[model samples]
Target: MIRTPASRRHGFSLVELMVSVVIGLLALLFALRMVGGAEQTRRSALGGSDEMQNGMVALFSLGNDARSAGYGLNDPIIAGCNTQFSDTKGYQLAPATRGTTDVTPLAPVVIEAHGANPDRVTFYAGTSIGGTPTLRLTSDAAAGATQFDVDRIVYGFNQGDVLVVAPEQPGGDCLLVQRSDSDPTATRVTVAADAGMRFNGGTPTATFKGYAARVFDLGPVGSLAFRSWSVADGYLQLQATGPDDASAQPSTVAEDIVSIKAQYGFDTRTGSAFQPQNGLQVNQWSAAMIDADGSGTAGDAADWQHIAAVRLAVVARSKAVERPAAGAACTTTTAQPVVFADAAPVGVAAVPTTVNVAVTGDPVDWRCYRYRAFETVVTLRNAGWRPNP
Candidate 1:
């Protein structure tokens, strides 16, 4: 077939061309599939990261608040004063569970005289507006206007500061307030939040920070009850009531335990050699409480100067988070949250730990202590306790 080369040109047949087209289409489809799969993987990874970060933040918040639990009238007031309300109120509400009206009283630690007022907040029965609970404050806690209006203003401020609840100043719309211990109200000795100011208002009028203090002076359960006091064994001990029940009685609530811890300060050893278990010895307490120098309880409650410092610790933890399961890849791995008490290092603050039990119905998530377990010794010798000199 050696015909003239130009005349005998050879090329692909129609069938062959169609077959090529099909092959090309198949390759394109495979590439697209790969790209879609990659995008999906990236989205999944990002979602996991967000979940972990959110869980961490929630846990930290729970820890901070829980740590401050049980810091009674004499506990360390790291932020505010331990003012015993003479006869006033701060926060009153029908708690999630309770029996009496919760109240926060005024303390001698007057923070102000005539500057600003606290915002009075009241939440009660109301119409469901926009699918939400609706309630307004009819009484202004701190209005300073000429005609002081509103009836009784209830209040529950921080646990250790002087918060006053009184009638809006006679004529002014704003109410008179004091926070420090040096209040000038000798006759009245009352601190009043105008119920007309914000919590973080620029002036001394503000008391509560991110969250308001629970100052209920009632039984084990009260809305205003931040912490409760009871005599266990002739010892004045306190515990968190409403928000600080960490033992998980009945059934555990969301991070049901925020924080809880305690400290003990004793006076110098008076009669005999001290034993770590018998409790604090403050009979003839030394200048410093807790027997940092081995003394007894030298201070008295009547005068702020009578007693020395005491023990204090705060326990906190976040509400429990939803748990996920482990798979075949996690065969030999343990499944549980590891707490400090469990082979954890000291000062180790962490969230729930997960081990792979791979069992049918055991909890994979473990709860950390509501309160970071630590104790701090305080000395009220010259300041909070009686004359130690």
Candidate 2:
């Protein structure tokens, strides 16, 4: 097939070769565009998924804790100022549950005064009350046993678990002690040297069947938990103060949580005739009376016991930014659509309470990203079981 250069047949015209090259380039550009679009779509989907997962986890944790609030305490709800040992609400019998402001614990009345409000909820509970007792003393109660012979340890009762020994029969005395020896063998537990001998104003003289003991694990050893949730730097954080520790350090629970709002459900329906169709009503603390002294106020502790449920709402944003189509109605001025009143009306006898956190500092163009909202009404099981005071 050899031929002379001139006879090699003129390859093709320069213009024709240029046209072929241009077509090939166009096909390659089209394929590149498709790949880029697919990648962007994948990223958006993954971002939205992450946002949803975070929201669910946050809600679950908050709700679970709320249900167990005020467990094993004498009273389900205790007034912030009430120092009455009998009426104190918590496992340790202090003012167990308090809805305080970011600065100080506020009565329901002054919660909405601040423009951006975050609540610090502090409470404690025993390991279990309704279910089968996990840790019960195997020895009888007389004056005191050097070490506790527990029936079983469900989760490996660690050292420092607050132990409360209560008598099976009413009127018998109990004891509150902190476990000292670190033994996960589920048999014997050593008690602290300074453990209280008289529980509930009496000493234990009954046998193992006569008295039972339960442990309260407050995260760290030898401390009651003072757990709180707040938003900082666009992340929802959970913090706790050990019984021994005064301050709490927050750990991020979820990212991109912009705001949190809550409302309390009070069991206001008293007597069948006066009761509304719904047994629950929102409590704004407007009707609650305040007593500077920690005395037994009429409406303060009285109203706290009526708290039956809590409605919580939170808003989260996708981690990745998204671009909307041109001319799309994608614009949001504020973090949320609802209007948050910065100032309450003067002399307002009863303003509807709206427990919410307002995020300030940097405004986010919420329209540029995907958003998810999580809301649930959590029933306080312990509170519900208690009758209205």
Candidate 3:
């Protein structure tokens, strides 16, 4: 309120005050932007990392098991992986089984007798769960139906079943399963629980398991997806369902999965390419070869047993961890075609698709980064493993 000449002169000039205010605002905006960018980078990195790790776990883990696909269960080891279990209609022969006094690993075979008829020899996988299946002979599925299950005896696999973390429920439970006799002790079990079974009252003679199992083929020319070992003729099969409360399908957590891509592998050196028993030529490289058909003729193809390497890829999509635009919608389509050649003579016309969604998941929080890409090589190593046939 003073009107003294000295007081008036001391007051700040209009331009000086305006400049100071502008400077302060500019600093505040710059700090905010830096903080925001750092957060975004972290989120992106996190999403990528999560997907990469998941993919590695899937490929490497399976590769480790497949390397042992067929070991000590075939003649000349690698060569016998393609041997047929049986050609009879009455019943399929046993898979991996305890070797008889007369049987030797050199001539690994499961002989089944139809009473007076001579015993039939079949190749299979044998696994060890509660107790190690030293030498398991391949046996048929349930008496009435043709479905693989944890039973006293199996028809296709011997002791070579795979044991690893499940694709759907990794690190959840543990189990002992069976694959083909030719398979090593690699892809049989499907448990992440502590090794060994629980003998509460008494451990069930068998346990449920699914390892390195995948949608092998979608029939010769149908959209119907089948497991690697599915054979309409042999009839013994397993079905994989979508997310569910029960075990068959778990991990409904959307963001948990980033991306999944699969291709068939074959014996390239064979000239004929790696073809399964059913006579389907495989095109891509693979860590392990499936029987193709329940006919159980993996080891039979010397080329397959000789395979050396495989090609694998995994890509996952997570929600933007901190998308400035939260309510943003993502565009997804099933038409995103994945064309996989039919291996040889006849190829699939239309490209089969995996999945597509429009924002069902969200990105992770900022701070940590998630690697996005995962690529690897799986070499065969086991009692009787081969990558180049």
Candidate 4:
């Protein structure tokens, strides 16, 4: 008989086993909760970064164009109107005249949709370096001549470029034509389309100074960038094309931009010094501040020329929806407007500030979302180049 040593099998009691299993499960649940919290924080940080980046890009694009508004045009005054060439409704392949007038009553900047959820702003600018962008003529250009000779041919000029020939004396001898040549080395460019414009009716004037005739390239026919910025469907959009291009569509510049506010910076001081009579260092900016002729009256189109800078603000929101604490409500108590430090509108009740914008087309509560605001002042370098008439 095998001596069966009583097996000292002290197996765990059922109560002991059950208690141990319960403790293990509790530890696992706690670990999962910690991981979930960390992931939420990461998502929030990433979303915030994206919103800020979008806002910055929007501001940069707008500022770049605003600073160069009057680039190549010799005229110090910038006038906004329906250009003569654009009246036919297409991209301006040729030079155009101001729809409003030859002089005075010009607007380089136009604001639309004021006091609304999304505002629209339009501005005009040239790509030329500065005054005296003309090249001397090498030979005489006959009436309806497809091409003309120029002493200097600059690089970067492409086919479909627009050329302007204006009299140095500021008389009525102006010719606007479109380039049909793609050759960069060629001494002459042909004009396939005139857009019904002529310089002295193709007759060379002895008063005009050049080998044959003096001319200048106002960038490419397609280079005339007529851009419009607006907030639509929760996105900041940019519509850039020839102002006449009805077929052109707007492109998305940035996302989650809900609202925009802007103010025009004006120099209302009457004396030689920069200080205004109001005792302010700079005349406070306002959406309604106007001083076209500095006659003490406001609202004239010429007032736009005095706009030295633009005080702009943009408000962005998160793409994701968040919830309150487990038991907390989804309501938000404070919705503050964006404050502008440089703006001080005169006689106006208040400066136009960005406010809480409503989000639509969603089942989730918008109050649970987060928002960010960005503000900056963009100086118009071209505006300063123009002398006050």
TM-score of each prediction: 0.30, 0.55, 0.39, 0.65
| Cα lDDT tens digits for candidate 4, 1-389 | 75644553567778889999999899899998899888778777877787788778777777776666545542421232112232133322222222223321223444553564666766565554334255666766654566677776645555655566544342234455556667788777676544532211333332334464556666654556556677877788776555344334567778888777666767655545532222322355675445633655454433554566666678787765666788877654246545464334434233555565665665666576677777776766655554333
**Between candidates 2 and 3, which one is better according to TM-score?**
2
lDDT of 2 by residue, 1-389 (tens): 96668834788778889999999999999999999899888888898898898878877877777776655442322222233111012222322223231111112211122223544333444443243133656666446554666666635455555555544332233445556667666576676454431122223343334235333332323244435666766688765434432332567888877665555555554445222223444433221223312333433444454555555556676777676567665543234433222222223123233433334564544566666767766665654443332
Q: What's the residue-level lDDT of 363 in candidate 1? A: 43
- Tens digits of per-residue lDDT, candidate 3, 1-389, equal 85778846778888889999999999999998999898877766775665555546644533443444334322222233211211111122223222111111112222222221111222223223222222221232221111232323322333323321111221121222223233333332222222221111112222223332211100111111111211111111222111112123222322333333333344343434433332333334332234433233442333334333333333333334433355643322213323122332244232232322112233433212222334443333332332222
In order, candidate lDDTs are 0.27, 0.48, 0.30, 0.56
State the displacement of the C-alpha of residue 158, model 4, in Å, after optimal TM-score superposition: 11
lDDT (tens digit, per residue) of candidate 1 on 188-266: 1222333422111223332331112221211111232233322211122233323334122222222222222222223
Residue 309, candidate 3: how far off, in angstroms?
5.4
What ranges in model 3 sit over 4 Å off?
A: 1-4, 7-10, 13-15, 48-51, 71-125, 128-255, 268-310, 317-371, 379-389
What candidate 1 gets wrong by more than 4 Å, as runs, is: 1-11, 72-187, 192-389
Model 4 RMSD in angstroms: 8.4
In Å, residue 59's CA in model 3 sits off its true spot by 3.5
- lDDT head-to-head 3 vs 4, winner: 4
Best by lDDT: 4
Q: Residue 122 lDDT in model 3?
A: 26
Scanning candidate 3 in windows of ten residues, the lowest lDDT window is 215-224
